[model samples]
Target chain A: MADHEIVIAGFGGQGLLFAGKVLAYAGLLEGRELSWLPSYGPEMRGGTANCNVILSDTPVGSPIVQHPNVLVVMNAPSLDKYEPLVAPGGKIFVDSTLVTRKVERTDVDVFYVPATQMAADRGMHDLANMVLLGTVLRETGCVGEETIDEALRHVIPARKAHLFDANKAAIEAGKGYVSAA
Target chain B: MKEKVLMKGNEAIAEAAILAGCRHYFGYPITPQTEVAAYMAKKMPKIGGTFLQAESEIAAINMVYGVASTGKPSMTSSSSPGISLKCEGISYLAGADLPALIVDVQRGGPGLGGIQPSQSDYFLATRGPGHGDFHVLVFAPASVQEMADLTGRALHLAWKYRMPAMLLADGTMGQMMEPVELPEEHEAFGTDNPWAAVGTGMKRPHNIINSLELSPERLEEKNVERFERYAEIEKNECAWEEYRMEDAEICIVSYGITARISRNAIVAARAEGIKVGMIRPITLWPFPAEPLLAAADKVDSFLCVELNMGQMKDDLELAIRCRKPVDLCYRVGGMIPTSDEVLDHIRALAEGGR
Candidate 1:
């Protein structure tokens, strides 16, 4: 692809920004131009949060992805806000457990994943973001699995290095979830 | 140490300042630009430097004035309202000929505007951020990497010219994240100037630094000398970038975040054979008037995009002497104009649909 714009949105504690950062880093590792912009608002913590991630062979013009080719929404509010903005023939990954309403656009491809439920089943309650990331990787092929793995190694802070293996497992399980479906 | 890493624009600017040998940082907390101070607070002490959270923006700017008078690189940053509070100190710094760096990561406002990205401070920065007929070298960075790069350049130019410099950025540039290569670390600028206020100790007379000259004639003389230096800077330091201008019929003029969006619109317009180009001013103070004047001879018309009510458009009109029709496309407050919206305007202008 010449360029790919993605927006990941959810509540504040959902790691939406982190997922975007990881993807941006992966694009950097692949030597593509990339930008990651996080939403800044008054109510940060329990408030709605979103981030725009752009990957391009050419330099990215605006970091704000007004119309994204791919949107990953983890909550109902995010789905409501971003669903109408998805480009035609775009791909949307909706976390079915949190976002109950089906996507309304027929021109775009919508994939429903039980990210929260899958994380719960795997006993990793807060890994839904990673699951969605893996599903995005499988659907979009925007970043290689090796790049995502390498990016994860660098992105996980040294203080939280112990969680790297578990996060890797979550990613694999997420990709497996899609293949099985 | 990794040379490239994902970094926020605000944090990148702080890291770049540290690398540029700016050991003294004084700032107050404000929205959209608090990260610059937070980064300095966390890292300055670890690097054996000073980071003071002053009581107010005015105090922070005065602290910068003191540190810079000693010939060491020092800086303070704020949002639009807080920067307004620092105007007096900025004028004092200019009057005393002390070099310092001031960053204004702008938000919307004539008064405590929203903490969203805005380029409304263009006139304030380029036309004289402070009073007393002085000009601060203003650099408008369009990207996160340029935020880091220009912070270093801004202080360097300030030190070279013995004048205050300002990095004109916005909330988007400060909050966004991208890969940046941090500058190599350097020692703090040496405090060994003949004009420094350091105690003489019977070694050549004492050097006194003060902005109060009292005499109208003396102040006028000082202003004349300062304007001379500014003229030299206007001749030498103006920087800009031209994109797709070789065969362009219409040229778009912009800077900062608006320039980033214009680049996308120009690219899209090109694919549709609209023949659009861009001129992005990097140095807002030493505004690149000459190239723009030359481009007026080539392009049919000019479209100026800004995040404010067409402030920079006046600068473009003044530059090209109103020889070409200069159209304005802008949005006020903190709303960013979308690329598609800009493209629509460009398409209209191209097809004579305007």
Candidate 2:
């Protein structure tokens, strides 16, 4: 069982926190210890927002992820700030639609998924975060894909149940894109 | 076994308070802790409980005092600056020997400090919240599970001791989410208070709940009696966790979120062959002196890692009676020390001893 320290960074309304929650829920469903911490306060209103998610076989220590092995950036600023902090041999998932800059690091694997463009193409303008999350899952295999449905059920409230199918479709689209690429 | 659910620390405290039979919540919203009030507002009405967004922190605490006078479980929560506004009411609760739960999700502070995690209120909480010699039962939680568990415990202990109790957390603990198995709802223990000022029902003498002892002698006696209860509390209620202490040469003293960070540092340092362990104080008021004193006889030195500028270091020094050298490693003004920073301190201590 591998441990994953994941950092998801993007604009406030980009659903980064929700993506992290989905990952955290997947970890929980598998009986792995996990923690999710977001960049809170005024920054969460409209500025840069980020969340740290850790899934460990043992009890999690320090919810703050100073060094993330799995880094996901939905924007260029997030890329510039967090790219250098990824652990060596780690994986970086970039939203190529929003962040066009190439990752400079040669020590880690980089996945450039046009998540925003892909989601928009599929009429899931708000689901780019989920698409990016799908890429992270397919690449790292940090958590099994079987837990996605149950995890989504836990996170998406009943009132928004209408969007559940779209979220699932978006994730599948992302997984399919990664496979074809 | 009860199923576990993921919840933020602030939300966990609110739900736990409800499960613990706290029917009335009076609080003013403050950052990093506003979730507590939000949860209560949504749940309290449905459960026939009262959740009032008091006009001010002062008003909120006084409302708690009113509910507490009737021997009911009541609570109020706030961040650092908001807590400062409730100091007078807190003092009144202490003077009258009222037991109520106060949750302080502390942020960086001296005056309207940044809305970031901090433990700078160590002295403000442990020494006393306001103008008095009384001590509240201060419980510091290092995890979301502890955040829920200690809330119930704090309420029970407060009612039992007839003194106020506090759940001292920071922004990190309040905002972080973790899986926790909340306690089952049950009747709160020690709810039957003989001294309560519930209407006498025309049978017994009226229970006068007042802190105004005009006579110098009577006031002195009342304070002395409270101190006696405080002594018993210190003896029986101190709570702490010791990790990897069996052969440790360097001991780390920390609590709340800082304790979690220190645990990571200790593990990393141990991997590099440093004999380091941690003594995390769960009960800040009681100070967990016995364990620190015991560790003093074993470890070469102690390091107090905190979010404040060495506030808890004073307590560590006093607890161990200066038997071993104690050092302070800290960050303030909403900045949290990273595990690497703490690891550096532990390494420096290890090398200094060598």
iRMSD per prediction, in order: 1.0, 0.6
lDDT of 1 by residue, A59-136 (tens): 788888989999999989989899899888999999898988888889998888899998899898889999998888
Indicate the residue-level lDDT of B156 in model 1: 84
The segments of candidate 1 whose C-alpha lies over 4 angstroms from its true place after superposition are A179-181, B186-191
> Runs in model 2 with CA error above 4 Å?
A179-181
Cα RMSDs of all predictions?
A: 1.8, 1.1
After best superposition, candidate 1 residue A22: deviation in angstroms? 1.0
Docking class of 2: high
Error of 1 at B263 (Å): 0.5
Question: What fraction of the reference interface contacts is present in each model, in order?
Answer: 0.67, 0.86
lDDT against the true structure, each candidate: 0.90, 0.93
- Predicted structure 2: lDDT: 0.93
Identify the candidate with maximal TM-score: 2
Model 2: per-residue Cα lDDT over A46-162, one tens digit each: 788999999999999999998899999998999999998899999999999998889999998999999999999998998999998888888889899999889999899999988
- Per-residue lDDT of model 1, residues B1-354, tens digit only: 555878899999999999998989999999899999999999999999999999999999999988877778999999999999999999999999999999999999999879889999999998887888999999999998899989999988898889999999999999998888787776434446778877778878877789999899999999999999999999999999999999989999999899999999998999998999999999999999999999999999999999999998888999999999998899878899999989998988998833
DockQ of candidate 2 (2 decimals):
0.89
Minimal lDDT window, size 10, model 2 chain B? B186-195
